[model samples]
Target: MNITILYFARIKEVVNYSSEQVSLPDEVETIIALKSWLSNRGETWQKLFSGSGVVRAAINHELVDDMATFDEGDEVAFFPPVTGG
Candidate 1:
């Protein structure tokens, strides 16, 4: 399925792109799987999504957990945890 992936905050700087359109292979079905798939791109991806960072996700503008399932044309976004003072 095809999905639009967005990067925000530190993720955008790490990934080097604000957004991208990706065609996911059939094996990828959830947000966690998507992260693994993207991480395979290179060292940078691996480091950014290694689960050691406070990464947050949203689908179609709605916050979702790792198990969230998405379909074609879905907009998936990745960002760091927000903090306020």
Candidate 2:
């Protein structure tokens, strides 16, 4: 399946990319799996999605958690936790 992945804030900076289209293997059906798949890209991806950081996710513009399931053409976004002063 093909999906559009987006990065925001520090996540974007760390990844050095704002967005891209990803083609997932059939086994990657959930957000958690997608994260793991992306993490395999390299050290930078591993660091960004290491689960130690406060990463937030959204699917198709609606905030979602790791268990969220997505299909082809879905828009998935990852970002750091929002903060305000």
Candidate 3:
């Protein structure tokens, strides 16, 4: 499926791009699956996406959990947790 993946904060710097269009293989079904898939891309990908790391995600601008389902043309975002005091 086609999806737009966005990076924020340090993730953006690590990935070297703010966002990119990706065509995910059929095997990827959820946010966690997507993270695993990206981690397999290469060193840069692996470094940026830690399987057990605490990364926040949003599907179509709505914050979602790892179990969230996504479809073709969906906009997915990866970012660090936001903190304010």
Candidate 4:
């Protein structure tokens, strides 16, 4: 399946990427699976996606937890916590 991933805030800065189009393997069918897969890329990615502090996610502009599932053509976004006064 194919999807668009968007990075925001600190995530964007850390990954040095704003967005990307990725084609997933069959086993990568959930948000959690996707994160684990990406984490396998290398140390940089592993540190970003793995560990205790998992960046927040949004599927199609709506915030969702790890339980959320995605499909072809989905738009997924990852970002660090946001705070404003």
Candidate 5:
């Protein structure tokens, strides 16, 4: 399935990309699975996305948890948690 992936804030900086379109492997069915799949890209990906809570995720603009399910054409975003000044 094809989906759009968005990286925001420092996550963007670390990934060196703001957005990308990718075809999800069949094994990747949920947010956590997707993170694990991407984290295989390299140490950079692993550090940024290998575990829970390090970054926040959203699907179609609504924030979601690790277990959240996404499908074809969905927009998935990742960003660090926002903090007050």
Candidate 6:
């Protein structure tokens, strides 16, 4: 599927961009899987997405859990968890 991934905060710095479109391989099925796949791409991707670091995802502007499924043209964003007081 073709999805748009938007990066935020420190992740944006590591990826060097705010967003980009990526074509997922057939094996990728959920948001968590997508993140794992992205981390496999290269060093930069690995660092930002490595381990269990806090990252938030939104599908088509609506925030969703990491288990959310995606399809073609879906906009999936990866960002750090937000905090406000």
Could you tell me how far off, in angstroms, the CA of residue 27 lies in candidate 3 after the best superposition? 1.7
Name the top lDDT candidate.
1
Screening candidate 2 with a backbone cut-off below 3 angstroms (N, C-alpha, C), the clashing residue pairs are none
In candidate 6, what residue range of length 10 has the lowest lDDT sum?
Answer: 44-53
lDDT at 39, model 3: 86
Backbone clashes, each candidate: 0, 0, 0, 0, 0, 0
What TM-score does each of the candidates earn?
Answer: 0.94, 0.93, 0.86, 0.92, 0.91, 0.85
Model 5, residue 58: what's the lDDT?
Answer: 97
Model-by-model lDDT, in order?
A: 0.92, 0.92, 0.87, 0.89, 0.91, 0.83
Candidate order by lDDT, highest to lowest? 1, 2, 5, 4, 3, 6
Greater TM-score among 1 and 6 belongs to 1
lDDT of 4 by residue, 1-85 (tens): 9999999987898889999999999889788898898888888889988756659999999999987999899999999887778
Off by over 4 Å in 2: none
Candidate 2 per-residue lDDT over residues 2-79, each given as its tens digit:
999999989999999999998899999898999899989999998878858978999999999999999999999999
**Cand. 5 TM to true fold:** 0.91
Give a tens-digit lDDT track for model 5, residues 1-85.
Answer: 8999999998999999999999988878799999999988998999887645479999999999999999999999999997769
Candidate 1 lDDT over residue span 1-85, tens digit each: 9999999988898889999999999989799999999999999998888858978999999999999999999999999997768
lDDT of 3 at 69: 85
Give per-model CA RMSD: 1.2, 1.2, 1.8, 1.2, 1.8, 1.6
After TM-score superposition, the amount by which residue 24's alpha carbon in candidate 5 deviates from its true location, in angstroms, is 1.0
lDDT of 6: 0.83
Flag regions of model 1 displaced more than 4 Å. Answer: none
Model 3 over residues 1-85: C-alpha lDDT tens digits? 9999999997898778899999888988699899889888798888766645578999999999988989999999999888768
Stretches of candidate 3 above 4 Å error?
51-53
